[model samples]
Target chain A: SQTIHQWPATLVQPVGSPLSLECTVEGTSNPNLYWYRQAAGRGLQLLFYSVGIGQISSEVPQNLSASRPQDRQFILSSKKLLLSDSGFYLCAWDRDRGSPLHFGNGTRLTVT
Target chain B: AQTVTQSQPEMSVQEAETVTLSCTYDTSESDYYLFWYKQPPSRQMILVIRQEAYKQQNATENRFSVNFQKAAKSFSLKISDSQLGDAAMYFCAYRSAGLNAGNNRKLIWGLGTSLAVNP
Candidate 1:
């Protein structure tokens, strides 16, 4: 069975601070990883996705960026956070194309 | 551009009853996939059901089933014998099956419908 782990279930940081959220998958290799953000009582917005190491595709232009440093490790980072950056960030992984995505417990980021 | 729509913002159902959540989408591509995801208060996205555009028959998983109307581009999720645990935010999503280079696998999501089950 594969499992996804995301850290810092809830985060509170001041404005203009750096942000780093990590997601890792176990029991699978070369999986597709994705980052999605959801606003309060709203739908999810695709932020980024990676097919392999050092390959990332950004869906929206914003303050956040994603990196796939390893086969199963994906990190979402930002040099400086904005107030609009606050939301529920979710990390997901899939075995291959046309596979259902498995998500990790999201991190609720609050940029004050 | 492909887009998904879920008109219902919130819905409620009595325990042990049946409820259907509607979803509609617009796309020019013929090959594609549709999915319904559940997001609980824990904020974990769980796959409820999926339907391939090429398949004519609807897909069912335990108590959850989907009404897939490919011609109309409509996919709705139906919950039978609804339980309190079924209460959550339901989302409809679409993914293009075309073999494109950039974002053929990216999922486009609709505004979710919050489902509440009363005990």
Candidate 2:
């Protein structure tokens, strides 16, 4: 069975501070990883996705960025946090195209 | 770009009653997949059901099922015997079957519908 782990289950940061949220998957190799932000009523927004090592694709232009350093490790980072950056962030992984993505528990980040 | 639409922002249902959440999508791609995900107050998304564009039979899981109209491009989720535990945000998602190296495998999401169950 495959499982995903996301760190810093909850985070609070002052404005203009750096941000780093990590995600790692177990029992899978070279899986497609994705990062999404869920805001109340607006739905889950796709922030970033990676197909392979060191390959990252961004969906919407924002203050955040994502990287795939290893086959099972993915990181979401930001140089400086904005108030609008605060939301429930999720990490997901899928075996291939058209497959259902398995998600991590998620990390709640609040930028004050 | 493909788009998924969930018109109902919110819905209320009595316990033991059946509720249907509607979803529609627009896409030019012939091969694709539609999915329904449930997000409870805990904020974690779970797959409720899935429907392939080529499957004629609707998919069902326990109390959950889908009414898939491929020609109409509509996928609606029906929850039987609604429970208080079922109160949550439900999202409709779409994915393309064709592999695009540049586009990758991404899920196009709907705005979501808030389902409220009354005891």
Candidate 3:
């Protein structure tokens, strides 16, 4: 069975600080990965998605960026965080197009 | 860009009662898929039901079922005999069907509807 793991389940960062959240999937190779952000009482916003290593497509331009360094490793990063950047971050993987995405437990990020 | 809308921000139902949550979407693509995901207090996204545009018959999963209106582009979830565990945020999602044909497989999600179950 495939499983996803995300680190720093809860994070507290200050404004202008650098941020990094990692997501890794097990039991799958070359799967499509996605990064999503959900604000309190808001909808899940697609931030970035990648089909292969070194290829990242962003949905909404923002301070955050995503990268797929390895086949099953995806990272979301920011050089300088903003207060508005605070939210719950989720990592998901799908076998291919039109397939259901499996989401991670998610990391709650708070920017002060 | 495709957009999904969940009109009800919140809904409550008595235990063992039936409740339906409405969802509508806008898309020009002919082939696509609709999904309903349940997020419990734990916040894990669980697939409740899925409907393919080509299928004429509705899909059902035990207590959960979907009323798929392809012509109207509407997908609604019906939970029969709702339980306490059913109290959670339900999200409606849309994905293009022709991914191998250049359609992005990214899921377009709605704001979500919070469902409450009363005993």
Worst 10 residues of 3 chain A by lDDT: A94-103
- How do all the candidates rank in terms of lDDT, highest first? 1, 2, 3
The better-scoring model by TM-score among 1 and 2 is 1
Candidate 3 lDDT tens digits, B1-119: 88999999999999999999999999988888889999888887888888888899999999999999988989999999999999999999999987453356578899999999999
Looking at model 3, residue A24 earns an lDDT score of: 98
lDDT of each: 0.93, 0.92, 0.91
DockQ of 3: 0.69
**Location of the lowest summed lDDT over 10 successive residues in candidate 2 chain B:** B97-106
The DockQ of each candidate is 0.81, 0.75, 0.69
Highest DockQ: give the candidate number: 1
Candidate number with the higher DockQ (1 or 2): 1
lDDT of each residue in A25-108, candidate 3, tens digit only: 999899999899998888898899898999998888989998898999999999999999999999999986667889999999
TM-score of each: 0.98, 0.97, 0.96
- How is the predicted docking of candidate 3 categorized under the CAPRI scheme? medium
lDDT of 1 at B71: 83
Top candidate, metric lDDT: 1
Write model 1 residue lDDT over A25-84, tens digit each, in one string: 999899999999999999998899998999999999998999998999999999999999
